[model samples]
Target: MKAMKRSTLATLINATLFSAVAGTSFSTLAEEAQAKSNQLEVIQITARKRVENAQEVPVSVSALQGDNLDAYSSAGMDIRFMNAKIPSLSVESSFGRTFPRFYVRGLGNTDFDLNASQPVSLVVDEVVQENPILKGFPVFDIARIEVLRGPQGTLFGRNTPAGLVKFDSVKPSQEFDGYAAVSYGSNSSIDFEGAAGTGLTDKISTRVSVLVQDKPDYIDVKAPGFEKEDSLGGYNEMAARVQFLYEGDDFTGLLNYHVRDLDGRPIAFRANLIEKGSNNINPLYDNDVVYHDAASRSTQEVDTQGLSLKLEWDLKEHTITSISGWESAEIYSRADVDGGYGNDFAPTMGPGFIPFSSETADAIPEHDQYTQELRLSSNFTGDFNYQVGLFLFEEDLTIESYSFDTGTYDEAAGNYGLQNGYAVQEQETSAWALFGSFDYSVSEQLDVTLGLRYSDDEKDFYAKRTDNPTPWNGSPDFLEGRANPSDSHVSWDLSATYKLTDDVNLFGRLANGFRAPSVQGRILFGDVVTVAESETTNSIEFGVKSDVLDGQGRVNATVFYFQMDDQQLTAVGGGSNFNRLINADKTTGYGFELDTEWVLTDELNATFNLSYNKTELEDDTLAVAVCAQCTVTDPTYTIQGPNGPEARAILDGNSLPHAPEWISNATLRYTKELEGGEFFVYTDLSYRSEIDFFLYESIEFKGEALFEAGVRAGYAWNSGDNDYEVSAFVRNLFDEQVVIGGVDFNNNTGMLNEERFVGAEFKVKFF
Candidate 1:
């Protein structure tokens, strides 16, 4: 792929800006300015456990209010709505409907293992979600979502080496209010969501919310005996939240409950590609092939439940607060490999060969987790604020895996038998931490913050296997191992912000952070059990935030450098077998992030976010290949693999997988209110620079650009005190077919990428 020309990049940026300006008028802008000035209000909260301006939190944070989400979703967008809209944030899920990986400033987990730990932590209403499955829960009825970039280990002391995302739902109010919306779209898609709340008394209130969304699969199943597309994907999500709040003269109490049940077809995995010029077949049709014989064709069900409580007391000079929460989830799934059975015998040998039929190599796993956190925060009378917290977490996971080779069974030779083996594995881990932070105002124009945290973690693993089934598979059938390693360490961060002017601020941060050691499943398959060492990172950043153009626009920009010691990474090797996790000797990353929002006119708004990242392995010795000369023994030495027989020769100095060097997005929105209702038009474009998907980086895959445009036209009516709206919208108007990810993992026989589809929708709202 060739590098993009400077002129082309500039053209795209300018076009985006022009489109936004084209949608508004001067008269409308004047009216909007006057209206906003009259309605402007201040938002105060405890971002640092004290009342302060949202902009003075001393952190890189972005917040989206519930009304903003309602407007975006009404325009046919979901939580993914914020992708590219925020700097230093990107989200991508696997080929299946599993948990999505979120990257912040080029730091994230890339391993596909089920038990892998993520560098970024997610907190919903002060409740920590430990299971990866629960991380994918849909976002709804939220008061606001805050994305805090950079390490937050001092306040959120779990696995926040990268950053933290917090979601605060709309709690119960002492007033009667509710919202309901229903939408129907193409592909048999239907979405119904509603939330209602009422005050039982002057001091008590309750709220309930629910969501149901369903859609047909995109692929067409064509097997001889199956009625539906065997490889298509779909999802069903149901969730609810209830909250209670009580306020007294000196004390405030709040409690809430949340539950979610998700059942969906994981992302469908295509095993092989249809040959070129093969009758122009539909790409959505499944071919009878399996990559690892471990693939499955089934839906997974994940159930999550949690509870949270908070209490606050107003003292004479300071406020006292206590927060506690617990969350747990269970997941079950059955995958089907080999969409169809085929003849196992050599085609040239004979006609009596029978195709093996089996559902082996499938997996069923379950996990449980519990967490507790206690924190106290207060503000001193003279320009000082402080917070201290303690956290504890534990999790247990179990998996039962089976493999069967259902071909011609030779009774005499156990090796050529019809069955292979059954395996059972279990893993358990626990973690605890204590943290504190303080912020002080050194002068009228300068502010500073300092924070520190200490943590300890432990893990244990047990596994057992049987080649044949028998009652004698007893207590000794399992091998147990424990990793009781503990680290008593401290992490600290310091930041100083200076108010250069009334509308501008300059800030710089120096932070030391660490990621806990991760258990490597690959070690369980080898002769020695080795634990990957913890990773430590030092980051230095400087940035400016300003409200410019007479308060009509806001821009935030930052440049940072990160040095990581013993970075954890997963390296791919022969035949889908690889290291789950290992500590790279050294890795360095540097990047710049810029985000701006401009209210160009009353009817028009524009937002753009861009990120530039460059990461490189700093050590040369660790990149050396293990089998540099064993051509016959190394299965990945084929002509299609990196360097052919010289495969191992090309294993050094490559960019990490999935870490693109450049990514950007721009959006333009225009809204016009008429006598009947309102009309909204939005257009967004995203671009990602070329990325190397493999460890060796010999195979080059070009990045893609995508454009999504939408329009919402509606009519609303006010009947008595109730309101109603009817609207129609379309998404992906251009219908661009962009590839999300490409892989050539198995013998170069298959290529897979996410497909594009256009959708039209109708929505009705009653309030």
Candidate 2:
């Protein structure tokens, strides 16, 4: 009888998975998961926007809901696939899947400037996706994905001093239902998603979501007179969302709209890609082959849109909230910044050394963002509770850059149209905030939290430089520079939460964060427009949030430290394709993080995360430039460059460019229910260690220690109103290709990672 019901459902799933991990306890999100009975459920988090129960949330959060966010984007991932998947998080980008670039703990801001200014910070649903092409929005119908870490600037404001990433989606509840999925991988890659929700009355409700991914042109390129189409890698992405909900009694409303599109392929970087001074990856690397030669044919395009509105009211014990948002984006990227082909005074060149033939372009054309938030809270549950807020922000940006002239090439044909160079940058930002949070219970096992914020920031910047292929250094330089930086800061956070038993909870936190005053202008190759002055961070944390074995495992650990004043730093591309903005008199970091969850039975469950950070940069009269050919370990000094001298490099303590002092990730899942439904396997792994792709230090730019893995297998059932699944997957499961980011002015270029994705998936649901 079907092999005796698969051996009696694997012996009743190993006796209910270790008797449900010795009698159950676990969970967190699918809307803050709260299951019971079948056990292992009851973990919720909002990291202080209240939804509590993450062992009482004293902040240092970590969350990624259900099926680990559907197996991390299910191949066809983006948002740098959330590099290192949380725990001192990290995500990088050279404009590949749009503009990722996020880092926490070790801070971040590697200036790929499209108005770059980051220290993490990206919130969705609660708005705040301040640029970076609207933070590459795409990650559909999510229900949770926290990762709060450090210095969240009181309730998230400004460019959070290295922290905050929150996304919450899936709302609209009279509950009708939804689901649809598709996946197909390996070079022809395809991924699709769908969602739906309903409720037409009884106070209205609605939801809709969609995503699509595509891949083609399958790599393999060589340009010689470029007829364009060696196909430099490929992608096509689309996104959509629409939501509405209205529930009234005391009142509530929510509306959201979203859109995105991308036609990719612009980060194939790989010229001598390391290995001359070794950072590996260059035995003539090939993942289908590449040689971005005579560039320009490699392109990227993006478009984005957003709109949001949230409202709530209930004045019996106090409750009111409002959020409004609008965002728009346009982006264009064209690469092949010297990853080989024509140079050495061109006629032709090799994949080996293409010393001069960077053809780049970056654009935003125009963009806008606006936000407003207002809040008031305290809805019963005494012992003093409070929350107050007001926030507003605006941004208008425009950035453009172009350069071409792959050096009069004719080595057979590829004649890159001479656009020489062009530049323009404009920024306008205004910000305001006033926030408050308070909670006190004093006894009953202690509880305290205080948060305050008062921010005011402004920026008006300008930079211009039209055409300059070195025509006597100045072709057009209308303005060259301008910045009107303004700042006002007051960030705070104080926390305490001791319940020490009853499933433990012990916490302590002290925080202050800021970042607002930064402007960099790459006037198509320098002309002064660099400013970095506002930076501040002060942090301290301690933690323990347990449930441990007795409750079927769950451990959250923390230990943190921070200090930053000035900080900010960007200084990219030493041989010069410029991006300079520096400020660092001090910068520091210390970390420890661990989040664990285990049910390990009753069909298995496991999650593990680890982090250890250490970021320095103590500035000893800070220096900049460096890398006129690898190997330069600190103390250098030269500076003259407009075409002369320029070696710089002092940066006192170092450590911060892409910071990676060990990070870890793990996941394991197993299930079996046989007869007519359930059978699963899941695997995931991530690791990071070495990193240092700029700001001094060398050995070919640095970036090595790495590991990645992914796997999935499945069978799920419930038919009638439907619910089905069938899967097979693998994503870079040991096809390891490493070498991430490096292009210190060309030769030895770099960038890789993402190849090896085999897939199969099908899902349907309507329950």
Candidate 3:
């Protein structure tokens, strides 16, 4: 009976799709084809702070819709996983997924400091997330994701010397629509998410979304002191969002609230990755770590909440929009610092030598952020259009560090007598910007755009320390200081686009961007206070967007060159673990990117994306620390006279860290019509050339060329207005052991990428 029912259902779905397409009249089908011959599917974007067709925009931008975005994010709960699908983008996290750092086009910060600022900006719903911790909020229930290459200074302001990533959520709509995608994979990993929305009144609507991910441990525990089984590398995360919308005769308003909770173990690091001279991994190792002193298990939790309100009013010839937002979060992470058993270090530190077990705990117990923006835009149907806006932001952040005690050291005074007097620091930041953009269509085939922004930024920092043997409280004896630094700058961009034909556009753009001044005051452990002046970048870019093959294929390509002055870099000096900020004289780079999408036939589609970047520090005097994780690689090379036999792993003319020479992503999809449903197969491959993890490249901290692939086969059906799908998928199809990052601080610690997983997924949609 069950088999009969399944057969009947399949027939119903096949008939529905077949009739829907075959029932069309021959003349009507021909007319539809003619209408689509010279036009590609229109994709709308807000890259210019206003609604515009992506093809008509004169910027180098890539966008992915919600359905396609899920394909990338489904592999992991963190946003960093999307790097595989997007060219010109790379991400790595030293503190785990909650602190992912993003790099675009060879521009990014390699600092592990909590207060470090990134060149790339992450904007969600028009609100900027300045803190690195806040940027890790998982991405779910999104409307679209956009990546803008090069400097986005005029619109986004500071910390965007590289580019910007934008995420827009699906807003509340009058019609009810929602979907759920659930999957169960290897290691008992489960993923489930869903959203639904409906009208509450003639002019009001609401939407609610939730996401949950749970996974069990996969790594085994094999150590003398720890006897637990299956107790590492696991996670559970939950997130939800609510949105409300109201529309009146001349006004529209949207209110949204979101919350997230995460509990998990971050990425694991393997010790003894390499020795002193060479940059290769030691062969006498397995995929596991020894933890006789500790359980080799890390604990981390992050809680985040946010609220935003958006209001828009229509005037006779202009429109006004306002956005106000508030966000708060508390995060804590604790882990074994040494990444292995401590027995080997007993003879190095003398009579005080403990078993070498060490652990560090970091917390952001208090954090709050608020922002407001207002804009006025031209709404007239004319050749000239403009938008002027004001933006304000304020934030208070605090960070604390703790080290645990091990019996081999002082029990009363704490671990190595260094646990109690660790560190405590706080910072308050406020910023504002005034920006405007003008657009004019000079003629039917030519257009010009100009934008300018003036931004002001300020930061206040406070820090204190104590030397008491016990847990030290805030004391006056410890080095204490406060600093208030402020900076202001002007950024601008100019662009011109010429329509080569009805189906192609050629454009060029020149832009400038800046990063605000930075201050590091982790003075509790060390008495170092470092400050960096603002960094700026000037870019020149040219691009072309075209639709060919009778609208069956679309292509976008861009070439860009940029020069940055006073590039802020982090240097760990004075033989301490603390890092300081320094400014390099100059750095320059050039890059090119290409994206193409083709529909080979009625049933097959293909896409390809590629990017290449090269960058170098021009300042000959700049020498960066080498072998940060592994103290030994190429020890003999430090005997040069350039800086008096200094150990410099990163020197002048070295390509920027985390900058891969080549990155490419390709996808192929095929679909076939069935009786009551459709069957489809999809596959994708991503390749990245070798990448360095630190400014001073070390043999042990660089990843060789790696390729990752995934494949999925699915069946889809339609019942009335609802649709359903069942699919089986395999991630990391070849089980490639790609090393995404490394840790050289303690005996060559290395972090590996995700392992292979096979799973089945079910999805349903209704409208």
Candidate 4:
């Protein structure tokens, strides 16, 4: 009865997708898998712009899909589901499910601004989602997710020095198909998602997919002097996608459109969650309760739409392809920045020194992004093949930032509980790139490939501050500030693969990539716009891939070293309400990764992944401002800051912020034949070492190691080539809770990881 009641909404939503059930593009993906004489299936990837065996690819790549992907995203989880699942990869976000920040090989950006640039990029259906907002598109009906590690600039364009994540959706097919999935979990979490597709005609096919997620606020908020409305830990999000494919004698075209709507809360910055002198959580930190005094705070909303078209023409021995895309989004979010109400000015302030009350709102009123690419590839059955492409991109964005008073109210002067400061920033960006990849097979055991890309990037940026904080003394207003940054660079990579045996391969790769110049115009608190110059990286890696124990086990290992010149860095939240862009003279990183999979028995399987990364700045004269409260571990010296002589930490050899030293993951699956079906159990675990939240080393800002585990069990059976499944899942099995990020500008504020959740899921697919 409970299952039926929980699945009712999903049934209705799926019915809206059409009269068909939900899945199959993933199960029947490869026409020719080339599997060995074993139970394990062959893995396929598009790491080098071509579908090939994973072992044959020279670059380090990992893929997650099928039931595994479903298990992680059972309870309306966002894209952060990929965190710590693969070697050398981490995902975190301060904006909840809106903008996920990805780090590959310990290289990433930590700026929380709307216009921040990332070292890692995201590509959906071969079109780059360059903007941070677009990168959070709901994950549904995705056929496969590939993570290409290391420098991918030669083929993926700029802002890819760390790597890139690619998501490929299931395209329209001639046969009629559909699937529906639903899960009801703790926190009143409901995940309803499904897809439907069918052939309208012999030459035309279409597919539609939709997703809906909702959760109620479960935390209690106690405000002593004010009325509190919406609590934290709740959200309602919906997304839809539609695609049409047209196939001709020698041509094919595909058009896609998608939209997203989300209503959620901002990150709850727990004031003084971390102790002033230690890394551990303070005694006042409570997972299920909050002590916010701010009235009517915490509101967030986001809306986005995108459309793309792809066309391809097949010549006798060559192919030409074109892709065009456009995207736009708007968002408004307001939150109590200090995590509480009543500043030090009031005698009732608790939770540490309270400092001062800080409340702010950020909005993106206008945003537009356009991209186009043209490519030509050779399909000759010879030793040599090549692919070349030309890409163009443009974007225009506007940001509105406001500060509000959270203390006493003065209706006449609008002092407290009203708007205090306001600022607006606008930016326009244009970029173009020409990229090519060439491959040659010298023999049956040796293959070599080369890639090159030339990119020209530029940005036009301006910011203005119109209002100053009236509740307290603030920086003077500034206007008419302009910053135009531009640059051009050529990225290249060379790789080779040597077949050591029928089931083993050794590969080596050398690549150089660069992130384009970025401008920071977040002048809501600061008076000037800062720009970080182009940062480039040169990396080399060697690896071995092998299928052992009669193809029942697989192991892949890699060792890499890299050095970067003029590395871009962002100093955020160090007793300041601004993000400062800086460039390190030199930086270096080295790492090793190992991935292993084994079929212990016909009824059991296991997989493990591990990575160790060490990154450091090499400059001798690099220093940054230090936090006001934390116990500094680095040597501090006074420097002339915006105020006066301020303490600066010597960060010449400090590891990158949020870059963990070790990460590991493991999974185990067991199955047993049941009456007319199969009963299976799956469990997964991930762990990451401690990390510093800023350039300077401090005790309070360091995030301790975290380990999380999950389990899912279910029974599944087939009906006339169709599939049906019902499962019960538990995430964060141990109820692990730890701080994931920090707000250093204010007290010992900290953000936490996801909470424990339990749910039931059911899925139906028909063909």
lDDT of 2 by residue, 1-767 (tens): 01323653454344334322422344222224443334357768777776887778888888888898888876578767778888889898877788899888888888887888897889988898978878888887798888797888878787887788988998978979999898888877788888999988989889999999988867766656553544777878899999989999998899999999888778788777687766777776777676666555568889999898999899989988898999999988887777777778867787766767778788887888999899898977778988889999988998898877765543444554457778888889999999998998999999898998999998988878867755655445454778899989899989998885577677889998899988888778777788899999898887777775555567777777788888888888887767788888888777577777787667888888877787788778998877656787777877676566777878887888888988899999999999888999999999989899887888877888789988898899998888889989898788888878888875767788777788898988895
lDDT for 623 in candidate 2 is: 89
Give per-residue CA lDDT, model 4, range 1-767, as digits (tens): 01223353453334222211111121122224444444567888887777899978999888887767777765688999998988899998888888889999999989888999999999999888877888888888998899998999988899999999999998999999999999999977899999999999999999999999998776666656653434787889999999999999999999999999999877677878888789888777667666676535677899999999999999969999899999998999888777765668887875777888888888999999999999999998999999999999999999899887777575875445677789898999999999999999999999999999999999999888888664243466655568999999999999999987776788999999999999887777777689999999999998877776566777777778898899999888676667889999988887777777877787899988888788888887888877767889998888677666778788888889889978899999999999999999999999999988889899888899989999999999998968999999999999998999888776777888988889999998989
Off by over 4 Å in 1: 1-52, 66-68, 71-82, 223-231, 273-297, 336-366, 402-421, 467-482, 522-530, 572-579, 623-652, 698-719, 742-767
Across 1-767, the per-residue lDDT of candidate 3 in tens digits comes to 01223653454344333322322332244446544423336779998888888888999999987445767777455787767477788877877778888888889887766677899999988888888888888888898999998889888888899999999998999999998989999889999989999999999999999999998766655544444666667889999999999999999999999998999876665555444455565564434433323444367899998999999999969999999999988888877655555444343321112224446677889999999999999987889989899999999999886656443456564434235446777999999999999999999999999999999999998876554223232333356757788899999999999987676778899999989998887664456578889999999988777766566667777777789999887764322345677888898887677777777777888888888777877776776545433542322245453224545543566678788868899988888999889999988899888987766656666677778898889999999999999999887899877566765443455666677879999999999
Scored by CA lDDT, what does every candidate get?
Answer: 0.59, 0.80, 0.76, 0.84
**Superposition error at 19 for model 2 (Å):** 19
Model 3 regions lying over 4 Å from their true place: 1-40, 275-292, 347-358, 406-421, 467-477, 572-575, 628-650
Better of 3 and 4 by lDDT: 4
The model with the greater TM-score, 1 or 2, is 1
Clashing pairs in 2: 16-602, 17-601, 17-602, 25-40, 26-40, 26-41, 29-32, 29-33, 225-413, 225-414
How large an RMSD does model 1 have?
6.9
Candidate 3 global CA lDDT score? 0.76
lDDT agreement of model 4 with the native: 0.84
- Model 2, TM vs. native: 0.35
Kindly indicate the candidate among 1 and 4 with the higher TM-score.
Answer: 4
Q: What ranges in model 4 sit over 4 Å off? A: 1-38, 227-230, 408-416, 470-474
Models 1 onward score TM values of: 0.81, 0.35, 0.89, 0.93
